[model samples]
Target: MNGFAATLASQLTSALPATAPLIKAALRADPGLLNNCVSLTRQLERLVYEPFQAIMKGDLLKETISKGPFDIVIDGLDECEDKQGVEEFIDHLLDFFQEHPRIPLRIFIASQVEQHICERLEDDRVQLCNLDSHSPYDDIKKFLQVSFCTAAKRDRVIRAYIQEHGEWPMKPDMDMLTEQTGGSFLLASTIFKYTIQPATAEDPTTPMDRLPFALRMNGR
Candidate 1:
């Protein structure tokens, strides 16, 4: 309906604002023409995709956007009103690239694991990847280090302490923090937050005091 058409049209306009008039002309010729999901996809291909690709073939690519490829992030697929529409859109998208799969574009769909959605994506053509498959130890360590640096800048005490001492997190401290994370980014963030929390009179513990205790932490 209007949802899919509007969404696609917005993206198209964002990518190529010069085509807004053409899009409006097409809509004016046929009112609510893209109300159907299939029509929306087809018209989008005609009005947006084909023309864009055609322009890209010539020297016009430089006048438009970056020649480099980019990913389209489509989130909340499970929230679509028309479940059937979702299936058809996916089918059409995959079929569109059946012959030429090297198009400089990607679609990243973020959706809750619903039966219908899962069934549609479960195909040889689609490459499915999950966050659980990736090891986030290095990323988590980098985030922790950056977060501490930011916090230290805001707090004078921390800045003074760091200036007097070297880096707040030495090799041993970083190692303990990384080990305590146990490969869970959420746990790592939570521990970092707890460590950096303002020290009260009742429980006056600085990040330095709390960070070392991570070495003694137990239970995964």
Candidate 2:
């Protein structure tokens, strides 16, 4: 199995203890499948698909699904370095769903739009939603507020500034910063770190000085 698949399998096995015995059973049936030289397809079949089938046969899949929905969340598919492995994984995943139409498993994948991923997931079974359509301003603002509050307790510079100036990055300043970030968590995180980073010998700037500079740099 590839790194991504290996990680996914590990997480699934850890999360679902019942899979352990099924995996052990498969490995006992064919010890060679555990070898590193084994093909990804064979490894997946033995380790993942077979165990899932076992669970289904044991009626655990039905019992679990009867309670409610079961979702497997995979975050940042585009970030994985192995593009071919990702494609292969997606192919196998779609094939699994197609083969087992009765399986009530929902795979929630969060990824940036890439041609390979887009092409593979453009199937009728997949429901794609653009996350950018959702407003992230409130979430960003909360993150920034919590971050600054925590920093104020830790950073001596910020503490000193707060003592002298009532409150650093007052509500209006925070509102402006949140607006400037334009609902992008990445931008909000970058600006937060840039503004509150500790003073360095090469770039000696306190959070007090940098906060306003950050606001100006991002066109307040």
Candidate 3:
């Protein structure tokens, strides 16, 4: 992702002057520099403006409404290769929103807060969510249950185990697994997959016992 961002930034630095007018014509609703060339304009348009427009307008069925009022979500902003470009993008975006106070479009971005990006977006209208503050245990547990249930139905071993064990993952096991995960969805998922795999089997009477050991082994 970082490499892609860098490559994109390099391309933008070379092509921005020629492409700025085209971009402005394409995003007429967006309020920013129509003449000023910038490296991140294209990336910002695709990741930010386009998604914002889509969300505000709802689906692509343009026949229903001429315009839409909606919010957009952008994740992994820091992954972009161009640091200065990212800053400029945020600056123009904030400026646009400031100019058009009621465009019915909101943007949500998730990333490791960088200084330039943070400075540009720190406004009264913007809402910041700290992912570290959330309790992800319940969410991870729910995701694991749903994912495993789907996988179990297809895999003969898992399906047979569930039948023999009277449901492989009961409420109690879920609680334990959730606690062990410490609210990391990736950790929980990796552990769950390993536990259910045939190679990890130990001929145990219950699948519940394997969960704790598997999670521990995976450093969950």
TM-score of each: 0.62, 0.62, 0.62
lDDT of 3 by residue, 42-62 (tens): 545553444434433334325
List, residue by residue over 1-220, the lDDT tens digit for candidate 2: 2545456567768877788888777778887775667766777777877676666644676677787545779999998887777788788888888898777567899999999899999999889999889888899999999999998999988998889989879999999899888777888999999988889999998887888877864633
**Superposed Cα deviation of residue 112, candidate 3 (Å):** 1.8
Clashing pairs in 2: none
How displaced is residue 183 in candidate 2, in Å?
A: 4.8
lDDT of 1 by residue, 70-96 (tens): 466888989887777788778777776
Q: Ten consecutive residues with minimal summed lDDT in candidate 1?
A: 55-64
Clashing pairs in 1: none
Clashing pairs in 3: 5-81, 6-81, 56-68, 56-70
Candidate 3, residue 159: CA error in Å? Answer: 2.1
Best by lDDT: 2
lDDT of predicted model 1: 0.73
| Candidate with better lDDT, 1 vs 3 | 1
